[model samples]
Target: MNEHILLVNPWIYDFTAYDLWMKPLGLLYLASHLKNSGYKVTLLDCMDRHYPFMPLPDHPGPKRLKSVGCGSYYREKIPKPAQFLSIPRYWSRFGIPWDEVKKQLKEIEPPGWVFITGTMTYWYPGQVAFLNLVRQLWGKTQVIIGGWYPTLCSEHAHQWGFDRIIEGIDPLLVIKQLSSDFKELSTITGYKEFFSVKPAFDLYKKLDYTVVLTSIGCPFRCTYCASGRYFSEFWRRPWEQVLDEITYDYENYRIQDLAFYDDALLYRAEESFLPLLKALQKERLPLRFHLPNSIHARYVTREIAELMRECNFETLRISLEFSDVDSQKNTGNKVDNFIFEKAIQSFIQAGYAPEELEVYLLFGLPGLKAKDYELSIEYVTDLGLKPRLSLFSPLPGTPDFEKVIMHQIKDDPLFQNKIAYLYLSEQNELYEALQRKISKYTFFH
Candidate 1:
C-alpha cells in the first residue's frame, strides 16, 4: 500500500500579511518528490486564497485582488500574542477560518505521516495554533516541522510539540527518515536528480500565477543574509529545464505571471540567466515575469537590461542596500553608486520609465547613521528611481546575527519583527525621527 503523506503550509499569524507572490514552493517541491517516490501526497495550504469555502462571513462582499495574482488572503483579526501586546497593532491569522480547517482535516485520509513547513521565526505562534488544531483532530500522529523557522530556531522550537524537526534543506535525509516508518521502503538512488519532478502546482484547487527558481544558493555571503546558510553550494538548473516548467504552466494553467525565487538569479549571465531569457524571448510567450527578490545591481548591463525588456519582465527591483561607500563595503560590496547608475541608465535605454524602476534601500542596520539612510533614499529619488525602504531584520546564523543587542532580541524571535520595532517607542530620538522622515516618502506613506 502507498503511504499517504500530508503536506501542510501553515497559517501566517502576523500583524499584517500580503500575497507578495508568496507560495509554499518548498512544500510543493516536497509533494512532487513524494508523488514521484510512489507515495500519495496532499497539501493543506491554510493561506490559500482560492480555498473552496466561499463568502466567508468574516470577509463580505467582493474579494480584493490586485495585479499579477498578488493580493490579500482571507483574514480574521485574532487577539495579539502575549509577547506582542506591547506593540499597538491589530493581529490577525491570515488564512481560512479554524472551523474550515477542521472540516478539511476530517475529509482527508488518515496519513501515514504529516509534514509542516513554515517561514519567518516570529510567525511560530501560527504553527503552535495549527499543531493544537491538528492534535485535536488527528490525535498523536507523526508530525515533522521544518523550514526557516525550525532551521533558525531549533532550540526555541523544541517546546512546540512536534515529533521531529528537520533542521536543514536536505529532503534526502527526510526521505531516509520516512523509510523507517514503512518497512517495505527500498533504498533510493539518484534522489538529488529525482527532485526534477515538476512541483505539484496541480495540487492547488485553482491556479492564478506560478513561481520558478532557475538557480539555488548565492555567490555572496552578505552580513545580514541567511540565504548562504540555507543553501551551502550555489547551483543552477539548465535553461531548458526552467523553460519547460514555464511553458508547462503557460500551456496547461494559462499562467502568465511568473516570479523567480532565486537568490543569485543573474550570477553567471551567459550560462544561466541570459540563455533562459533569450529562449523566453524567442518563444515569445505572452507572459509577464517578476523578480520579487531584487537582482544584483552591478550585474545589470545594457545588454542584460534589453534582454529583460524583451523577455517581458513586468517588475524589476535592483538591490541597492546603501549608497554610502562604507555601508556598501560593510554589506559584501554588493553595489556601488557608479555601477548602480550604469544599470539605471541601461534600464532607461531599454524602455523602463522612472516609475517602473524600483531601488531597494536598507533601513535600521546596527551602527548605520539615520542620515546615511536618508541620503541613500534621496540619491535614488534624485536619479528618477523609486526608493523602496526595506527594514533590516537580523536572521540567526548570519554574520550580523551575533552583533544584535536590543532588548532581549537574542532570546526571543518576536524581536526580529522589523516594522514592529518602530512601534516599540524605546528607540532614540534620531532613529524615531528617521522613521518619521521616511514616512514622508509617497511610496511608504
Candidate 2:
C-alpha cells in the first residue's frame, strides 16, 4: 500500500504581509515528486482564503483582488509574541484562522508523515504554531520542516522539536535518511537532475496565483547575499517545460497570476529569458505576471522591455544596490549608473509609468554610512522610480558574514530585529536620524 503524506503550508505571522504571488515552490515540487513515487499526497494550505470556517467579513463582496494577483490576506489581530511585545506594531496572523486549520487537519484524518515549509527567520512563529497543532493531533507521526528559515537556522528548528530539519535545496539525501529509518518508504529516483513537476495548485480550494521558477541559482556572488551558498550552481529549466507549467496553471487551475521566483531570471536574456517571454507572448493567454524578485539592470534592454510590456508584466522591481560607484562595486558590480539609466528609459519607453518601476535600495550593511542609502534613495527617485528599501539581515554563509564578525554586530542582542537597522555600524545614530528623515517615502505611507 502507498503510504500517505501530508504537506502543510503554514500561516504567516507578521506586522504586515502581502501576497505578491508568493507560493512555496520548494514544498510544491516535493509534493509532486512524492505523488509520482506513489504516495497519496494531501496538501493543507493554511493560507487558503476560501477555507470553509473563515469568518465572514462585515463587508460583502468578492475579495478585493488587484490586477496582478497581488493583494491582502485574511488577517486577524493577534497578541504580539512575547519577544516582540516591545515593538509597537499590531502583529496579526495572515491567513485562515487557527480553528480552520484544526478543522482541516481533523477532516484529513492525519497522514503517515507531515512536511511543513517556512520562509524568513522571523516567520518561525507560524511554523512553530502549525507544528504544535500537528503534534497535538498526531503525536506519533513524523514531522519534517524545511525551507529558508530551516536552511538558515537549523539549530533553532532542532531546538523547537522538529523531528528532522533538512537544509539546502537538495532533498535527496534527506529522503534517503528518512527511508533508512522508515524501512517501508518508497525510494525517490533520479533526484539529481532538475525535475519538472507542476506545483500541486489543485490542492487549494481557490487558487489566486501560482509561483513558477524557470531557473534556480544566480551566477553572481554578491557579498551580502546568500544565493551562491544556497544554490551552489546555476541551473535553468528548458523554456518549453517552463511554458508548459505556466499553461498548465492557467488552463487547469484557472490561475491568473504567475510570479517567477528565480533569483536570476534574466541572467542570459537571449538564451533564457527572451525565449521564455517569446513563448509566453505567443501563447497570448490572459494572464498577469509579476517579478517580485529583483531583475538584473544590465539585462533589461529595449527589446526585452517591450517583450515584457507585451506579456502583461504588471509589477517589476530592479536591483539598484547603491548609487555610489564605490559602494556598487563593493556590493557586486551587477550594474552601474549607465545601465540603470538605460534600463529605466527602456522600461518607460515600453509603457511602464514612474510609479510602477521599483528600485530596491539596500538600507543597512556593516560599515555602511547613513548618507550612502539616503543618496541611493535620492538617486532612484531622481530617475523617476519608486525607491523600495529592503532591510538587511545577516545570513550564516556570506562574505559579509566575516564583516559582521569583524564589526561584532552579528552578536548583538537586537541583531535579529528586521527593522532594527543594525547594518550602519559606523554611523549608527546618524542612520536612525536619516531613516526618520526618509520616513515619508516608506511603503506604509
Candidate 3:
C-alpha cells in the first residue's frame, strides 16, 4: 500500500480575513506531486468555506459568497494572542471550528507525513493548534511546514517545533529537497517536471474557483515588493503548459472563475500573457478570468485591454501604489501619470465599467502622512476607479522590510501582522479613517 501524506491548510487567526480568490495552491501542487510519486494524498483545509457539512449543528453557516467567487470566510471570535493583546480589536479564527476539525480528523488514517502551509508569517498560531490536535491522534507523524512564513523567517518558524520546515516559494525545489532526504518522496526537478502535473484540485469535493500562475517572479524590483527577493529573475511557463492547465481546469473542475496569482502577469504582455489570453479567447471556454494580484499599469496596452475584455476579465485591478506624480517621476518605481491614465482610458474604451476597475494605492508606510492617502483616494476616485488602500506592512524577505522594520518583527513573526504593524506604528486610526474616506470618495464616482 502507498504511504499516506496529509496536506493541512491551517486556519487564519487574525483581526479579519476574507477569501478573495485564495487557496493553498502550493500545498495542492505538492499533493499532486506526491500522488504522482505513488503516495496517497489527503487535504484538510481548515479554511474551506464550502466544507461539505457547512451548516453544522449551531453555526449560522458561512458568510454569503459573491457571484465572482470572492467573499467572507466562516469566522468565530477567539481571544487575541498574547502578542496581539496590545491591539484593541477582537481577534478571530477565520475558518471552521476547531471542534469540528477534530471530529473530522478522527475519520482519517494516520499518515506517514503531514504537510502544512503557512501564510502571513504571523498566522502560525493556527498551525500550532492543528499540530497539537494531530499530535494527540496521529503520534509521531512527521509534520513538514512550507510557504512564506518558513522561507522568510526561518528563525521564527523553528520556534513552532514542526518536524520539518521546507523553505522557499518554489514547490518543485521543496519536492527535490524532500526526495533527497527521503527517497520515498517524489524525485522531480525544475519547472519542467513541475508543470507537467496538474495541482490536486480534485482533492476538494467542491471549489469556488481555481488559481493559476502563468509566471514566476517579477521583472520590476519595486522597493515595497518581495517578488525580486523570491525569484531574482522573472520566468514564465511555456505556452503549451499554461494552455493545458487552463483547459484542464475548465474541463475537469468546471472552473469558470480562474484567478491569476502571478506577481507580474503583464510584464511581457504581448509574448507572455497575450498569447494565453488569445488562446482562451479562441477556445471560448465560457471562463471568466481574474487577477487578484494587481497587474502592471505600464504594460496595460490598448490591445491588451481590449483582449482582456474579450477574454472576460472580471477583476481588472492595476497597481497605482500612490498618487504622488513627483515621487513616481523621480523614483520611476511606479508607472508615470501619462501611462497610468492611458491604461485607465484603454480599459474604459474596452467596455470595462469605470466603477468595476480597482486602483490599488499603498498606505500605512512609515512617515507617509494621511494627507498622502487623501490625495491618492481623491485621484483614484476622480478617475472613476475604486481606490484600494494597499497596506505597507513589512514582508521579511523583502529588502525594504529588512532595512526599516524594528527588531521585534525580526524576532517574532507576530509583530509582522498587518493589524499589529498599524497599531505598533500608532497609525491604526489613520488607516481606518482612510478606509472610510476612500469608500465615501468612491461612492458617488
The sequence of per-residue lDDT tens digits that candidate 1 reaches over residues 1-445 is 5878888888888877877788888788778767877888889988888889733434333342365777777788888767678776788888888788888899889786788888788787777777777788778577888877787888998988788877876445455555566433335433346346788999988878999988767888889998866765677788898899999989988986989998889888789789988899899999999999999877888888999999989888898988899888987987899998998999999999877877888766777776787798789878866777777777888877677666567777877776565455244455556656555665552
Question: Model 3 RMSD to the real structure?
Answer: 2.5
Q: What is the TM-score ranking, best to worst?
A: 3, 1, 2
- Deviation (Å) of 234 in candidate 1: 0.4
Clashes of each: 0, 0, 0
lDDT score of residue 344 within candidate 2: 93
Global Cα RMSD, each model: 3.0, 4.0, 2.5
Best by TM-score: 3
lDDT of 3 at 251: 90
In candidate 3, which residue ranges exceed 4 Å CA deviation?
A: 56-65, 182-186, 329-332, 403-407
The Cα local distance difference test for each model comes to 0.79, 0.74, 0.80
Question: Across residues 1-445, which tens digit of lDDT does each residue of candidate 3 receive?
Answer: 5998889999998887888888998788778877877888899988888897654323333553377787677777888778778888889888878788888888888888888897777888888788788789988898888878888888877876789888887656687667854575554656767777788899888887999988878777676666556764677887778888889888998877999999888887767688887887898888888888888888888889999999999887888888888656533365976789999999999999987788888876555677778888888887777888877768876655765556787777778787788898788888888888876776655
